[model samples]
Target: MILSPSRGETCDHCLAVTVSIQDAEPWCPHCEWNLDRYEPARRPPEFGWRWIDRRTHRLAYRLTRDQFDALVADGIDRRGPALARVVTIGASLLLLVGVVLVAAFGVWLVVHDFPSLTIPFGLAALGLAVVLRPRFGRLDESAYVLDRDQTPSLFDLVDEVARAIGAPAPDVVAVNDDFNAYATSIGLRRARVLCIGLPLWGALPAQERVALLGHELAHFVNGDVRRLLLTQPAFTMLGTAADLVRPVSTFALPQSALMGWAGELLAEIVQRVLARLLFTVHVVLVAVGLRDAQRAEYLADELAAEAAGSAAAVNLLDTLLIGETMEMVVRRDARAGHGPDQWRRSSEQARTSAGPILPALRQLSLRDQASLFATHPPPGLRARMIQERTAQGPAVALDQARLERIDSELARHYDRTVRNISWGG
Candidate 1:
């Protein structure tokens, strides 16, 4: 389907009407046309020298390309969550084994009366403790948490969508100024929180809002919330390990300049080696976590399409491209003393101005090959998936009056929040 153009311009290549946010230049979706023959292509998976690279990408996704195709063809229940569960369990077990090894080493050193070894082992255990300790200290403190009483209509809509999708309603809902929406679990109890970026929320059309909400809510059903809870510790542990080996400044050394210089030199050399080693480990952990995260994103997209219709789902993704440019426009206008009313107008104008640059942005993005670290698939890939799996269904019907009421409730809060946010500060 041709996306509604941001500026309502017809594609010159195909003479077909295009959606502004959806069609990035060089390639026209309507005609399957490419203007640039030399554009970098997506790299093919290789099994020989690039075995680890290939395995990383495969491990990151819930299904292989062929499996996704088969799943789409057969119309079966998604196995993403189950597959992700196995991967998460494997990662956790690996981490547990490492912890056990470290603890055993520390105990052996203590028993053998090796002060030097025991001291390092004790520090290692302490660092590991810091890394593995789950933290959700400031989750709700950072945002404006909404009460059901404060947003009855919005809660009503959320409840309706949750029921339709068979996902639990989020325990906490909040609004912020970002141009994104996400779900996060907090604390040991793993309470779910849904945060909606007010700027993005306000900018979406009513139908697209349904798509966005469905996409975020679907994370709960797809086990993304639980997976994140399980996997984040690996990243935290790696970060802690990095910090433990990071070089300390030698500037505070005693008054002897020669001694200080030698200390500084030694510190720098040690730091450089340790940094490289720690960074390699960090990269591997990120690679392991990324596949499942990306898979979860695609699965969520599928659920969103199922709940909100293919068109809206595609539009929502397209809007993400537009949203990036919108943010730049908002920041520029804000600096120029544009108030909330002026900011909204400037955002619309920015959306139109930024449309032409999207194709270039997309082309630039293609230069970076897919990796385990990428959180989402490239826009072109996601768009194609949605198009290929396009299902014919009506979006969940929302009461227009309730939607309008929700808008009113959000507008007041958004304006206040945006105006108060000091970007420079």
Candidate 2:
């Protein structure tokens, strides 16, 4: 560790240089700064150990003197280890047990034949598909670069924060009229594709844009991006099955209230019976979803702030949370009939326009959830994160006026988006 500059006084007990001699007590923080000392002392048992941050109920880091200094110097990494594999193992074991039980029972059902492990295997395969859909459903493009003229120069901003935290760069750009952005780990390679709503550039300052990028970047650096993607399909399948059979998210399966309880009890018994032969991977995944979500989000936000340097990111985040609630009339009606491309375009516009410092954002809706939530974190949590960091120590940055004017031109286009009442609303 680089030693601090020589200071006021030296310690008598140890050869440590102190930054200050304000208090009466003698404790030199650095190498022997005590001008006069009596009994020489040895270094403490734990030399350069300190707490860095927290991970899901566990203290996540142990910092040495040098590493701690490095973090503060290079800016701290916001992303941390995700306990995904932990959850994965838990789910897998549970499922394995269920598979064994199911396979055993299947054999017992036809003991003379004693050959029906196929049933359990089929269930496991189904679970695999649902669990890994995030990877499986990705576009396999070698890379998707933005059109040069259409490209936004978030490169500088994204690079600064990403380098600070050692996160991967976003590969996809959604340069449209939305305020939304998402980080997804896709394909076998787990490449991250970040989609940003174009209009936000005008509304948010350059640093604010960086902060948003940082938050999204945190998803990649943090395990949440991966966890959410990989576990999502399983989570949805198991939860939906539970809701349909036992009523976890929606109303109980069709039955009288009393009968529904009986139905749920029957379902539980059946589930347990099947579990003996089936895998609990989906069940455990379904159970731990929300807890993981909240924890991972915090780490991402903190990291984003560190990268962007202060609460400046918080301002734009706040704008999005507040302004996003409003719905405006726009011409996207031309691209109608509830398709993803249209929907993605609409969602992105609202998110970008709502930025606090945004010059403008086109009309886009933020309320659609049926297809969107599966891939992205909500904006509310991001807004709160910006607020929290600002309460502690806000990051600040300086930008050129010419660069800002470029953002302004982008803003002007949103205001002129045409309406198409001809299509269904």
Candidate 3:
């Protein structure tokens, strides 16, 4: 459906396009360029820009090549993966060490005749697989067609690139308001869909949409999705263990963040209680071997960029809106605010074809750790990567003024809408 108009025409501030004569109405619904700028809607960012996924570079709308490059390099943090690999090796070694240690500790439990959880845990594992397998089966049936319309949107573009990387088509799809696309396993290759949210596709430019899809597809092709699922049982158990350790750490007030984090990770040490002694060795063995989750995200980004070309990666941030902090939204309404509909909208909106695709990364505070870690990489890191090798284009900064105008216009439109309703009543 075509969206309605604002109070008047002439686009409030700029005379570039008027709402009165707009084909779609409401200040040119087909293209919602930044309102504050007097510049042409299709202009590039003032500074030259470089895309992060590839080694090639370009001039941005305005941001300098040197400055942007520094930020991008700083933003990406693959250090976690390196650390995780070492930990995996160390964890493996600890399994062997833990066996002897646990055996000594078990003498007390054995003599005291503590109940054996071996059978219980085995039963639990079986029960869990039984329960989850059906769920997976159900997902296989529904994931591809779950959406009301299942509009193919970016999926077709995604499939083109994903096939090269060996990813199958998604079995199901969900259209929501958010700017994200994720794949969950369904049963036996039937309906494993590459679900795309409508809001995201609608919001971004086609290239940006392609980039996003390419990234999600990479997750499937790289077996990241499967590994994620397989780790669930262990991850759940570890989470519970972490919860238990939280109190102990708080009670002890370990000297530093490292020690505190280490204490919480004692879930690793505690879970060996349920598994075989041999399993404990395995646990420690593989602990550091797995890629860091954050690193995996970066890897996926790179893969997507490569698949679609760096240009896709270049405008990715533009399409993504920071929106509300998930924590805040959860706290406020608990359910209504972050509902599926809103999520889908966010996704579709991120694909705006007119002007820029996404909103800038909203900087929350000087010391907000949550904001920095909210995305796969810090904004500075991703932004820098794109601008690293370039020196000419419209700077994304120009959008700030336009965004402010849109927000004000939206607010006014709503206010008038309320006044009209009250008067009629």
- On the 0 to 100 scale, the lDDT of residue 274 in model 1 is 89
**Which candidate leads the pack in TM-score?**
1
Candidate 3 residue-wise lDDT, 290-402, digit = tens: 33443455556665566555666656654443323322232222133233234334444434432331221212111121121122444434534554534323211113343
Question: Which 10-residue window in model 3 sums to the lowest lDDT?
Answer: 364-373
> How does candidate 2 fare on TM-score?
0.48
Kindly report which residue stretches of model 1 are placed more than 4 angstroms away from their true locations once superposed.
Answer: 1-77, 81-88, 100-124, 136-140, 225-227, 249-275, 328-372, 421-425
Against the correct fold, how does model 3 do in TM-score?
0.42
Score every model by TM-score: 0.70, 0.48, 0.42
Q: Where's the lowest-lDDT run of ten residues in candidate 1? A: 32-41
Best by lDDT: 1
Question: How many pairs collide in each candidate, listed in order?
Answer: 8, 40, 90
Local accuracy of candidate 1 as per-residue lDDT tens digits, 52-124? 6545544533233443465457643445455545665566567756766777665665566666657776766
Give the distance in Å from residue 46's predicted Cα in candidate 2 to where it truly belongs. 50
* All candidates in order of lDDT, best leading: 1, 2, 3
Error of 1 at 171 (Å): 0.5
Candidate with more favorable, higher lDDT: 1 or 2: 1
